[model samples]
Target: MKVIVVFGVFFFFSIAAVMAQPANRQVFWRDLQSRYEADSNRVVRVYLDKFGYFYPVNAIPIDKQLFLFPAREHNVNASTISSANLYAYFHANQTAQNALLNYYQVSQTGNFDRDYKKVEEQELRQISRQVHRLVENLQAKNIIFLVHGFNVTDPVSRYVFFEHSVSQKGYDTKIKPLYIEVYWDGLTSVSGTDLLAIWKHAQNNTRWVSLALRDLMRHLDDRLPFTIVTHSLGASVATGALFNTSSKWLADGNTHDVDSIASSIPAPVDVPIKLGMIVPAIPGGLTFVDFNHRSPDITTVANNIVGIAIGYNPKDYATSKAFFSTSFGATTLGCDHENELRNVSLALRGCGYSLAQVQQMIYPVQFTTPNIALGLQDHDFQKYMEDDVDFSLFLAKLFNE
Candidate 1:
């Protein structure tokens, strides 16, 4: 039996490798990066300051080892310390940043490592300050942040492109909200067999990011409305920010399943937030009920949000086996949580939620049916994005349309 299990894992990963994204997909990601570079001033990107992402984030996508933002920076667009890009005309920041520094004649130290480290820190700080300023002075009162899930590569490019695509649909004209693409350190899997490890890694990253996100929220104007649209394990990160106020993870260096939130948020997410979870990788039991007295202070997932838009697939393959909990029906909220959602009102009552609030969680079956060409059992998020009907319904619910 052990031998069979080992062979099965290997076969699964082999298939996953075979199904890796095509070459054309790289073109699309690069195109978005180039476009964002050309008009970066117009956008706001907030990413976790953990490890570097799988691919380069800032510079034009090439194998030249050039990076726009150097290693260990907060932004996802950075190369590792050892793989630092050369400082030259062809490298990142050459045309714009290097030219400006040259104009000022900023003196550089003879030591290359010392000079580069100083420059990297300065660039990272400037990026952080710019994002805070934009958040403080947002033209739109309603903000929509897009967060992706585990094993997603080049998310910065993909989500920035997604923001542009959403705008092209007249969403920007109608909602007129500031769109921020959030990139977290959701570790990518080395192979399909590595899914479990990365999933756990992503969850840990979620906790760290949650605290940072809450801090970011504190900087924003509290009067404005905010919403988040998340897919897959991004659901955990979203919930942690809204409800898990405990910073024990910071002090103790280990995760505490803290979900109970205080009534007052201290100028941080005091208002109700609209959450859109598409194919989320959360446990159904936790979604509707606070089992095991995990949050004895009271308040569960049902209490944290004013409105929710849940996108599910009854035949979803990813969430079904994301953690090898299929037989136990443990966490496949994307597929096996309809009954749990129906019972969510019971949980909301303890939170003192209004009838209207209870009624706002929506999922229409018609919007969730998978297409034939797209694998019926697969959990590819692009399937949801490609289907106009499902995507529109999701957006409508997210913005309370």
Candidate 2:
């Protein structure tokens, strides 16, 4: 019995020793930049930070070392890449530069749409002009926007990981559309008491971010195409933004500001727009119904969208458990809803949408947890994007040429 016990203890320790090593081969951002620096062709990355916008509009490289939290303050930064010094590539191109600068400027003005700054009117017009220029530069009709989920408090880290993962999957070489990342404070430290705070933050941030996105869309040439891809809590944000699409705002067709010139524009067409939600951490119930009367519901958003794809893994307990335990007591959309379409139909009917419309727009992509021995691997972005997990293939198919 002593010999058996000794062998069991040795086996346990051996397993622990092997697992103690780092899971991912940590690829430094600098190293990744070096590989792309050959042409000295810089990618003008657009950042919209809601956490602490510490960086200024066209500020110097604050910190090069990558970590969890990068900066402090409430500002947005727009800068270009340069090969001579990859760390500080200031974009001189006025058109593209101005568009990015405008993004930062608009974000500084409070989270609500009603709190519009005087300068925001002119800045939004400038954004519309610059966005047109970007479309011409890229010569593509579709613009891809990536919305990240929780635990990524650092804008730099989120940008690095997202761009790196996209490149690794050959998205850059394949699709040449302009890419933008919506960075908000989706940060939460897991503790017994932290979940409630995190939930509230997510709800508030989603509303703000969604309004920001709606404003961005309103300003852009409505003729241009857009696709937003979101993961986890970002899925909630995206849904909230979609659900919160104001009928009055759409009817007004532009900002109500006296100084604004982009007013009276045509309402967005009910076609060609797409939203891809990956492992969304939102309540399944909220996706279709509008709690308010005569407000734009999921069907209203669906009418304007050509394609909608939602990716979820039934075994993502991290997402499922978090929402289930919350005060909301809501079941997450990420978990397997055996009657997902039925739920959609019922919700759609509540919003006055037919089952046929549900069939036309809603496409749910199901995934199983990867058969790995690692804990929490099911919820990790690295597992979804880096490893040869099925999610990667699903993404490829989702955005395939």
Candidate 3:
């Protein structure tokens, strides 16, 4: 009897130990949760469901990283499971579940039209209040909004990057970090058609972003200055939000929209905002045959903004291949051009502009220390924070302090 009891006890212990082992999926979730919990300004909640996980809007902490997973529900199969899996399982509602099912049946089937619209409105209100509070607290400094790029479905990645960028550089004094994660829950497939559909969704998501920004600007104090940093596809969306859509205020020469613009501008000469386009996959005038077919309207905004910084890399396989296929009908290795921008110097070089030109147009600053080489192979921007490097200097340069 004693031996049997001991065996039962050992069996339970073994089972518990096995469950505790961290796998790729669980580790991802843990990292994501940690990032959210670290944020001082916001409270983040994460949920697990059949579709993987869902986070509250802008609830991700600014110093973590994770992969993107598409919401798939229809045509349920092995492909759907693998293609739509994001991080770990998160909670979902019947409506989201049904939408996921429909999305699985077709390439662009999910219509969060009604549900997401409501969510967007509610989130906008919440974000507006948050921005109001932030501006109230950090009255002395300028505000900079940072948006992340593609393949980042996890909110933690945004949080991790924001925290690291601000803390390493000690820009907390001069620039208050306002990180905004514009998520469309992009699909995870190498298929060109799927990728295009994802891009379209990203474009659609821009409306929510515009609403959020406009609302935030409305609440902010008139004295604060604002700047925006957009990476990868986020750059395209940001530019579209500002330039593609004609604002009623801009058309009527009303100063309502100008408030957001004027806050960022040192002197009003038609341009009222500063935009930093970092390691964007597609620039305004450039055309790639296979990747980005046309230059987005973002270029027009860049020209109009107070300052615009285009970061690129010649050796960046992603950018090179995008241009090669789109422009020359050749296919090259697939690499993420957004990640290539971390190599500050290479990013500047590939930006299709001279360093002096960038400085003259935006700000005369360079990211030094540990050198840009440290980030050369790092495709994940969040990794920059975890790894020991002198990234603080780069943060300092960003604030010009």
Candidate 4:
């Protein structure tokens, strides 16, 4: 009887030990770095600061053979520095890394390489032709530039979303997708102070982006039509940039000559922006002073331009409670937890527009759910995209019509 009892105790102890193993718990930086290094098709570069935390680096597809480097910086003020937060960041990175690897594989084995190379070579030869066409069409066309939201630790999400969205509407060749990813690798936690700090950092980063855009536009021989899309805290960043640009322009008597501006500013692409899309924008980020005094009247801005679409969902709990509470006064329940694209669609619908019209305006669409739940389940936008939601056709009708 004694021996049997002892054996039972031993069995229970072994089981508990197995359950407590590191692999069963959560993955951290070391595990992620190991997996990243082992990946062949995807390359992972780490930028480390004085602290142990690291930033992720990857390439964004620019042309067939060329890639734009998408660099991310870590938010040092993140609330939780625990193993769980590390796990979330790692999981996000893995998703992006996998997508890039798949892209590389497809590019190598399929016609992606051949087609892209052909396009590049053709583009090089027909630069003058394209330039001439652009100049001829320089009168005023609508162009939309998208800036991604916060907690986008992975570059793949942005690339996949952009690629799929652009491909859906055949804008892959016609429209230039200016993806301004301001990466401040924010830590996942439910702390308010930490979030505030991250928000401030994001605001600061906007100045750099603004300068870049201004510079990019100044050098362009022809200006194409343009719009700006910003999500989550990104809305704040975009607003900051716009406000700075407008202030600078006003200060300079609305002159486009920006040669004496700091070299850090991005050169402006010769693009004339006709519309601005503020999707479930965080209006709180703009203080009362800014809204009343400094900020441009978004409505007036829209009226003077082609159109402005404000995508919002009464069901988007996070945006409504956290972001919206800070931006706008009232917090309605209807727009809770809705994704960006869907919210944009709702905003358009509210303004008496049809789905088809929305689709004609924007291509390849994406939606995001609010991260109100505080757990592993909260960070699953990819899963939401993969679900059997007939968003493509629905979005097509909403934007294209």
Candidate 5:
């Protein structure tokens, strides 16, 4: 009995010890850039962090080495990656950078979309123009965006791990896929007591940040084939964007404001416009048309979508109703419903969607938790994206050439 007890404890810690670490952002990106044929070749990356002006204009990245909280296990010289050294990397805005480095002092909850300095028009146009130029220079065919969940109080930590994992899976697709990291104020710090309040606040913020994403989609050339891949609560950004299709500001179809111009973007009949939600943190009830009109008509959206893939795990208790939501919208338990897709399908069937129609538009990708013992980490995006065989297959379906 003593021997068995000792082995059980040892086994648990052993599994934890092998927890993965993100690759050096500097090294990984430099190698990616070298693969391109053009001398000015570089990955096109941009950022948007507007605190609910319901505004989402492109912003510049931090230039120097940054020490951030929720720090990764191995950051060389104890300095984490600086968002952008331009043509050479990834991105984060001023708000997330400050809130993360000073987490202990931050307010319990709210938006982190303030700017330390007013951005000049020329500065804002620089990266937007660079991205457009790079697309033409590198002959880039597709654009990819990564969106994170609500629990990530720290942006840099999530950025590193997300980008590195995408690279590990060869999901970046050489120069063909332009990767953009989208960061929003997701419950910037822990309140210590009211997790429910913080969770609801985080859920609400998605609505606003999503407006920015919606405008960005309008700004993006309709000619560009783009896809947004989200994890956990981040699904709201992609879903919300699809719902909020046009902007009055840019509705005139005239390109104003910044240098990059789109003469009124059109429907994606000519290109692939996809949205992937991996263990998404949303109410499954919303997928069907709610008669009260509480949620968007996702059933209608799904049918027109080129591809919308949903990744679910019955074992992801963190996203289970018992934990993720304590009160309102608790029943649907979006990530992994109690009855899984059966509930979603049955509900869809009630709404007049044939299971065949639901299956065609909404591709449900399954993730088999490697060990039931891992528990809550089962919802960990890193584990799903890096450690699971099912995630690899899901990625292939989402990023098919």
Candidate 6:
């Protein structure tokens, strides 16, 4: 009887120990990097710094999951000193150049011995070369820019959402225009700050975001037309930059139509822009508001774009509360009633635009309940695009036209 009892105890202990062992699952970051690498694609990460110049952000080999933004200083690590932000870096590695950097052995294994300044310099040259090559190719007539919203950590989600939207519209990478996904620090935790702080933080983030977009537009080939697909806060980023009259970003004598805006934007002369805002989390009718009577009205911004589309769902309760309520104390365009736009003339006039011309340039899209399937209450990228026939058809016509 004693021996049998002892055997039973021993069996249980062994089983518990076996269960405690960690599983050998593949790291998600590694898998994401490998997927792009397999296709011979190189990622070029563009990050705008406080100085207003966009810099190249890189990932260390020790863990490519974290990307270190280099600054102007050097500190020795692993027998090597370099200037970079080692402590403050993103854990997700969404930057596109992961594979190529690995191939070049940009960093030493388990040793931060490489000169980051040199690495950054080399990476910048590589990115410029890649852009020049693409411009010379002349195969793609247009480029798609993907902008994500706030409070996101997973890098793969952004890529998947981007690819899905582009693919759904019958645009294949092999035969269609090239695409670039802009990943910024959109992650915000509500536990730490009040609503005012959060709003200010978003303003700071978009400050650089606007500069990055302006820089990107300048970099692209002048003849190629480009379209933007932005979700949530991305709408704010686009509208702020396009309509902002006093931003120092445009203070470098690039003004066109000076009287229209005290600081008029240098509208793209060679390339056209088509803007799309999906589940945008901005205040209702904020885009159409006239900012300081002297400034070129939001309609002026609308005039610059070839087309604009706003996607909203009445059932998107998340935006209704988190975005609309918090920002304006009421439902926003993202959560407004379907017939909100029924009075087209009234809506167009509000933004200070003529219905005859701006009617087709800007429009709103309403999504049904069945199409909203991305979050707890459905307020994400997937909900806005997936299986939504109307949205897809809209894109087809915009791009086709």
Work out the TM-score per prediction.
0.61, 0.60, 0.48, 0.40, 0.58, 0.60
Show where candidate 1 strays beyond 4 Å.
Answer: 1-39, 49-138, 221-223, 245-267, 285-304, 322-330, 354-356, 361-376
Tens digits of per-residue lDDT, candidate 3, 373-395, equal: 42433334443333334334334
Structure candidate 1, residue pairs in collision: none
Give the number of the best model, judged by lDDT.
1
What lDDT does the true structure give each of the candidates? 0.50, 0.47, 0.38, 0.34, 0.48, 0.47
For model 6, what is the alpha-carbon lDDT of residue 307? 76
Task: Estimate the overall C-alpha local distance difference test score of candidate 5.
Answer: 0.48
Give the range where candidate 6 is weakest over 10 consecutive residues by summed lDDT: 18-27
Off by over 4 Å in 2: 1-56, 59-116, 122-130, 155-175, 190-196, 245-271, 291-302, 322-331, 337-341, 370-377, 386-389
User: What is the alpha-carbon lDDT of model 1 when measured against the actual structure?
Assistant: 0.50
Candidate 3 ranges with C-alpha deviation above 4 Å: 1-119, 138-140, 155-158, 181-184, 189-223, 245-272, 286-304, 322-359, 362-378, 382-398
lDDT per residue, candidate 5, 1-401, as tens digits? 11111233232233221211112211122222233314234444333331222111222223333322222324442122222212111113445444432432333233221221121122234445656776776577777777887656334455567556666777666526666666564554344354454565455445545655554554455257778888887876666555432222122232122111111212233345777888877755444333112123344434444566778876676576445443443423345555545655665567667667667656778775555454544666777775457777676667763
Tens digits of per-residue lDDT for model 4, 1-401: 11111233232233231122111111222333344544422211232111112222234211111111112223322222222222123223444434443543423333332423332233223322433354454422333445555444454465356447645667544554433222323222334444443443333233333443333333334455545555554454444434333332233233122122332333232233432322333432221113212222333224222333334444344445544543332222113333334554555444444577555443422344444553212223333333324334423332343
Clashes of each: 0, 4, 28, 56, 0, 5
Instruction: For residues 1-401, write the lDDT of model 2, one tens digit per residue.
Output: 11111233342233232112111111123333333334222223333323111122232232233222122312211111111111112122333334444554643333222212323344455546666676677675566777777655444454457666666787766665666556554545555355554454444334334544555556666355667788777775565444442332223232122112112222244335677877776665445554222122233544666567777776676565633522342435766445443565576567765677667667777766564433332776555554356656555644662
lDDT of 1 at 66: 28
| Model 6, span 37-102: residue lDDT tens | 433242233443211223333333434323322222143222111111221221123243344345
**Candidate 1 lDDT tens digits, 289-385:** 4321222343344343556777777666677563343432244566655554555555554445556656765453323545453355656666666
Which candidate do you rate higher for lDDT, 1 or 4? 1
- Pairs with backbone N, CA or C atoms under 3 Å apart (clashes), candidate 2: 52-73, 53-73, 53-74, 53-75
